[model samples]
Target: MTTSTSSKGSLQLFPFLDLKAQYRTIKPEIDAAIQRVMESQQYILGPEVESLEKEIAAYTQAQFAIGCASGSDALLLALMALEVGPGDEVVTTPFTFVASAGAIARLGARPVFVDIDPITYSLDPGKLETALTPTTKAIIPVHLFGMAVDMDSIMEIANTREIPVIEDAAQAIGAKYNGRAVGGIGLCGCFSFFPSKNLGAAGDGGLLTTNDPEFADNLRVLHNHGGHSKYECEVIGMNSRLDALQAAILRVKLRYLDAWTEGRQKNATRYSELFKSRGLDRILGLPRVQTGCTHIYNQYVIRAPQRDELKAALRGCGVPTEIYYPVPLHLQRGFSYLGYKPGDLREAEAVSREVLALPIFPEMSAGQQDLVVNAIATFYGTRAFAP
Candidate 1:
């Protein structure tokens, strides 16, 4: 509902994510939170970190939450807790941030990728069977673009196979599926506090959520050098612990998260309405929400006709755009060892070429969106729209 006066077709460009705007609104509280951490002089995992973990667990409706150094570390710790090691396979979609699969490979395990659902652009539960094998230890379904995968279908398949599901929910902190928060739906859910995330910290921070107490206990140990007691290491583990400073900052930001999510939701609705009114829906693919799901719109991505060209055109028009993943993970040079050819994962490959992210941050002005849409209209040679 925040509008901007049209610059008569000369739109002023802005950062894709306006973190400063977000910071300004909560400056006093953030400063106090930082001061608290500084005064305590307890920089590592301590009271502040433990308190944040409890808050996150309650927010996600999970039985327990474990904090880690980064989102990548969260995945690594979760896989370690499950004992997924050499020769083991973890199923995930290739159309996501590399950290999703990278964490699997870092543990000397294989990342077995499946195709994505064309409509949802997430791991297609239908094709999951094709990727499962005797070595399959876990299924990692990434909730891409802040939209939850069909949790009902995914859970049914995983439960039948007796395989654990780890949700890659770094982009979906506030998303929900069937009235349950995404991080709580899967066996183990991972979240990131990178500055760009919806619930970002001051820097790198991550959390793991689960209903299983045993898994929670193990994750705690794994995140803390695999020792139930200090200097008595039970197993191999890394030094991945969430620091107190980031935790304190996150505690403050978590309070305003719901309001921010609402702003993003409203922006998404306005974009869709504008696109439909301009008859751009026929040419561009607006986001689709499944029944009983809440998408946080971390990135309001659209499937454009000429995605790369459109992105360039938008840039010329003082609009910024980004391609989430130009290359699917299976085709990446590092993963070529997996021996995947070009068309192996058809839907993922196709989506990689067509998807482009628009600016949908909660603080984005209405005129910024209008300019982006009108610029796209001009690029596609559709009649340009005016506010």
Candidate 2:
């Protein structure tokens, strides 16, 4: 992306995501942890992975936790643990990452797409019961963008039907709902430690949390080639174990998660103030947090009528922006077999066109935020500005 120059003839540029900045902040601790893993020579699922699982379980207040290769695998493991297969259906929002529905499809199950709540951009609990069929096996409600879904309504409907809820909490590690962490609220929560997430690792990694001992045990076995010991096989499974190096790095980062979360929250507040002071809120739709849900701001997305034009203008002015998902899952070519048309989910289709994410990281400075907002102001001509 190209950025505009200042009056003093200096180039300004910002990346969509800056991993190196985070790395530099904790280089020593990360280096030592990696060195320790290399020296130990126990590279597979050893002490480091086990230790991280326990630590995460304690942090989320879950009875058990399991580590896996990626967040995609975490969802698959959860479905496998629950024995979801052909003739079964899994319901989820179409506005989420493909991994949420991909996991269900991989298990030979049908993915039922539902429209999201216009306000929260998450699964609408009111539409859930109507979407359920007699073959519905599980419900995967995503805590989209670190905001907890309407879990009370979802649970009330799900519990009555005896349908399991798998929370796709990849972006909401530290978020809470009614004072309870998002991961432990449902039967199982799947998280992603992709380098860009709020609580991320150096490379691809994921974790799952659950309160049921039997489900946790089943997940552990499924992620480890279905074997409890060496040279023994119990059931059909896949190779999706978490690496020791990733576990070590994650442990170092976990210590600062709360602090970083606070930073993000502060930045979100500042953005609101800046937009409101400039009257940009009249043109853009700011995020809304529910009363009982605490948002972690995994992404600070705003809706603008001229989203595409504004994004181009921001790029020209040295501010980079990204679209979380340009298209919903049901309309994807691969899922065309689901027999969905454009009008099936009107809200999701309309939202996919207007949502745009601005730069939001824990290490970002206030000046950088100003630069971003200034660029937007210049584009919309909302307030007088100089290039």
Candidate 3:
């Protein structure tokens, strides 16, 4: 409930994300969902979890959906189901969250990082061929910042090479590529239901979508300790199950996902319009939506000139901000053994130095967005941008 206030305690500070506001909006439905789950007394993979999987499958237009413990676990489960392990190589972007590549490394597979597209911040499919090798088993293209990657090119390459494509759609659950849902287009799509995700649950949860019946079956078995029948171990797997509480909560949220997405889209559009009107576009690189893709605006990240300075200035204005990632995965200390130098992925590294995310939650008001823009204009010495 604590927000930034003026010296007289009259003004409320806008947060980077207002989960509380979202909660207040849907408190009744959420509370009822939780109470129903409590009354059912089925907290494991019960009716709620089963219903969620079917609903997600229908939403994504995929033939099957498999619920798992977490988004991280979703990636790990996909890799496991695909039988991607030691000596196999998985190609992915170096600019995304660590879990994308960590899933590969965790399974003793090599994460061959490709640079990202400057416009979309997703993997540059042009560089994919160079990263591929005889040992390359799969491709994991992340739909970064809620924008879909160029699936046509990626799918063509994967099909030609006969390698599986696992989409890291943790940020793009409802995003589409050429009129197809993100997770369904790939061989298997992994989505995270982390509290901050577009379709977030109350807690940790994740799911994977696939058209392949065998892959779906394997993912279910893999997530539940690799057993077909109870106490029957068929393959070595980890225990990663989606809790019923999270699933039930997510089911309630799913009904309002489209409405929330529209709100976010409107906010994103308004921010662009505001920035342009204030002449901040010259100094701020706004997010770009691809020709045929729908951007859900999970984070309205912009590339700022002197990002660190702008961030501090915004903080003084009582407007919170976030850096989706200040460091690319290849440059991280733990991945140094991958033999990637600083200049290896120029676009990703360059973006890491300048990308700054402003507050763009679905519940954010136009006045609040104006405040965020005015703060940026003030930082740039534009005096006309008053809230």
Candidate 4:
């Protein structure tokens, strides 16, 4: 929602997410791609979408890929392929975007909420086995904030139970776990091309990757009204297809994704150095990357006491910050039918209250980073925001 451009005067203003500056850097390529799609009059899925599907499949090392309307739809299609329905349960963390749980509920299945690991902010594998039952249909592990989930522990637990894993890797396009891409490690990987993601398209787009041809075929049919050929009805499905223009534009941006990701990583390191030098590190809980996980830093979230007050102070100081989710999904009013109550999952509820994301876009300059650090320092005053 923050469409504000990068600041040019005195490094005073910072947008929570600066998509415009990113657009400026690749305007020519983006424009040409869009124009080509327009000239061809191919706005729906066609050669462009097919090409992107191949490129993404190769990028993630998956045997098959299919594009869809949005990340939320990708989750829905994956669930449909597995035939998840009433009397079944899908296990996932309670701290992720609503789409993770929403997809399960939409299919008339129950969503089982599990607590998250405090360090990784992902599903806690130690507690995973306790949530499974005979009717457990699948497990959806989210790669939150561009950090790879502890997939080894999760997969080991899941495989023993004979439960399939659908990875929500929307925030982690290029992130890796133990040298393997996040998408390729699961049964089917779901990715989002929302404008703010690391490898975002010009608009909404999504892709699914899987090694099973049957699963890929099911997903493709489900996304296109349950039939590969028009005017022929197979099974009940939804109307959700990726746009050709979006795929063309994504192809262009995909070329420079690694460089942009490096910029974000370097920026994260600079923030750490600044925080340590200013002793802010003692007061704030910076992100911790696990040994086998390669974090792409889609978001630079930090923990602090009185997070609300700190956010207000940062805004007053001309620094923009965002709370990834001020309220966890289980506690949401819309999901009260799920019968979850306060204190059910302590870590997720606790994290919802303390986490705040700062601007870590590739184009953010060192001066802008300095301004952010200085504002936090000024807010804490002499106590320096002690935890």
Instruction: Mark the regions of model 1 whose C-alpha exceeds 4 Å error after superposition.
Output: 1-12
In model 3, what lDDT does residue 371 have? 83
Query: What TM-score, over all chains together, does every model reach?
Result: 0.96, 0.96, 0.97, 0.95
Q: Clashing residue pairs, candidate 2?
A: none
Better of 2 and 4 by TM-score: 2
| lDDT of candidates 1 onward, in order | 0.90, 0.90, 0.90, 0.90
Locate the minimum summed-lDDT window of 10 residues in model 1. Answer: 1-10
- Give the lDDT of residue 105 in candidate 2: 96
- Compared with the true structure, what per-residue lDDT tens digits does model 3 show for residues 1-387? 357653444434866777888999899999999999899999989899999999999999999998999889999999988889999999999989999999999999999999998888889999899899999989999999899999999999999999999999999989988899999997999999998899988888999999999999999899998898789999998889899999889999999999999999999999999998888888899999989999998999999999999988887778888888999999999898888999999999999999999888999988888888888998998766755
* 1-387 per-residue lDDT for model 1 (tens digits): 322223344343777788888999999999999999899999988899999999999999999999999999999999999999999999999999999999999999999999998888999998898788989999999999899999888888889899999999999997999889988888899999999889998889999999999999999888898898889899888789999999999999999999999999999999999999988999998999999999999999999888988987887777877789999999999999989999999999999999999989899889888988899888878886867
Per-candidate alpha-carbon RMSD to the true structure:
3.3, 3.2, 2.5, 3.4
